[model samples]
Target: MAHDLTTPRDGIPPVLSTPASFREAAAALASGQGPLAIDTERASGFRYDDRAFLVQIRRRDVGTFLLDPEGHRTEFTAALAPVLNGQDWILHAAPSDLPSLAWLGLYPGSLFDTELGGRLAGLDHVNLAAMTELLLDVRLAKGHGAEDWSQRPLPANWLAYAALDVELLLELGDTMAEILDNQGKLDWASEEFEYIRNTHSTITGPAEATWRSVRGVASLTRPEQLAVARELWMIRESIAVEEDRAVSRILPNKVLIEIARLLPRTARELVRVKGFRRSEVRFWGEIIQRALESDPRTWPTRDRPPRGLPSRQTWAAEHPDSWERFSNARTLLDDLSADLAIPVENILKPAVLRTVAWGATVGREIRSPLDLPDVLRDYQARNWQVELTAPILTETLFR
Candidate 1:
């Protein structure tokens, strides 16, 4: 029978805001036995920064402890370092949470990422709620995750929800670990976990180029409009950061694009646009007008954005032989993925595969599967990934 988890087993502990409270919670966690179940709540969609507002931790004997990292940012790290350092951490989707946790100076010595484990074990629907229900038969209440956690005086219900995040994490980790071990993929999972733990989290790409990632920027054909969109995006980003609000919340992409396309000259013209009609125009109308009024000569160039490789369309047209090799490699990879019950992307990244295929045919020596490491050094294909897929890749290239 399925059980609905409405409240934490030991009830929600008070938010650890003060240094003394952090020390007390750390003491309890230190004395507790077994792996630490950890989760963090960040104000991502609602705030400018992605820092963790609430850090939730649970262990076998020590119930649940929620630390308000914002309250004691300076001291929380040192207080919990001894208890958390080198301990096995149980988390679902460790990559999403690890970076924010690392920002607080907390790093796990080892970790079991339940979601990745489930994927490796060939289980679909690996999200926390789904996996918990499938493996442990517990239904977690959904929603409330997107709330602005930076708000003072967090609600009691929200606290309960945060505590529940870590409630079944360790249990889920154990179940996934056992399944991986039985399937002889435990070593593979361990390597993946270690990689996640050691990897530093940093934003990629130039700040100016970040605007290009807006939803519909690809549709704009003119360099002037593209420049307008870039300027508007930069302006919105600046306001969002200063106000500590989400960029989308400040101005939706659709409205921003419309403003660029029309190049609204005045506050009256700007507010006439769909999303800018309300308080947004009153607040940011001047800035938008200024951006649109900038000289066209100063617009961004029409050159394609920098990328590691060309698109598949360009590759197929430019180099048919290398494309043939890539196609064959993909087929082989699909078969290997099906046989191993792991996703093809997990087996080898698509970019790495393409790079290897191109290099293999273009005067690069790849006598055996073993030489893949040298060819893939820059690509950073892991040993486990290369070991499983290289033989097939080698055959595809040589044949």
Candidate 2:
């Protein structure tokens, strides 16, 4: 009963790039009667931060409108503000799309993330195409997601692919809602959707964590290498923000790590290193060499602060008691996950589990089972999550 969704039933319209086009599209969409099915194409890994280049919105009868938001921010916002206001939105994976949309001043009133709903409904594959196929019996054509959407005069095939992104979302949302309601997870999914709607980030560029997040930064053995990598990462990040380009596209992780590893002393030496073939490498080498030549006295400590409890690798040998508790907790949580038909991550954040185990045993942060609520709250565990998990963890950590 599955058919390939190669094109929109009404066909793809022209990209609404101009103010007049946006207004017309808005008027058409506003007249349609239903929640909006929305999706955005962002150049995250390929460009800078998640800035949306294309926004696709669909309604019951309005069909699909591909919005070109670049260089027309004001027009795009002004025209569509009234249309999107106070309307529920259906998005496949809400988190990735929401940030860029928020950057464009588009916020949802209510959200139904089909991907999350699929997880709550206990579906195996929670991606957009997978959920649509399972719940709507329609297979979507994909493979355009990784392309640079900022290109003008977008290809016909890519447009069709983008159109299909929102085309089935309305029916898919309805079908998913019915399943969630039948499975008695409607309230849970509602809570999740509301959480996503309320929480959005409009950050345009890298934050403090950018350098540390580089692929091979953690693997560099020497403190000097980390210092050099951090410096090089900052240079890449600054240029990425200024030009609105992706950091990796500007300076690949493989090349950056190699330069840092070699501790290249000059622009000439820097360019000679392996994996340094970019056209900009010679120019970037000068700026990078400055960081490498700086005094080592100012270098940061080699060890970055742990994100959470001591690394689990060390827990067994360095902190055996906490390791044992963590082991037991995982087993208990895994069994609970199976019983409730919810993924382990959906039941409780993995960080919360690790922190709770360490807190109760080694950290001595929990005095008794009564202390579980406050500890869990610190991690922003949802009320429903805390309710479902508190008793289970209280017994596990305390015992």
Each candidate's lDDT (Cα)? 0.82, 0.83
**C-alpha displacement of 340 in model 1, angstroms?**
1.6
lDDT of 2 by residue, 104-158 (tens): 7778889999989999888999988988888788999999999888878899999
Clash counts per candidate, in order, are: 0, 2
Report lDDT (Cα) of residue 222, candidate 2.
86
Backbone steric clashes in candidate 2, count: 2
Cα lDDT tens digits, model 1, 158-236, are 9989999999998888899899999999999898888787774342222343887888887787877787788778888
Cα shift from native, residue 193, model 2 (Å): 1.5
Question: What is the RMSD of candidate 1?
Answer: 3.3
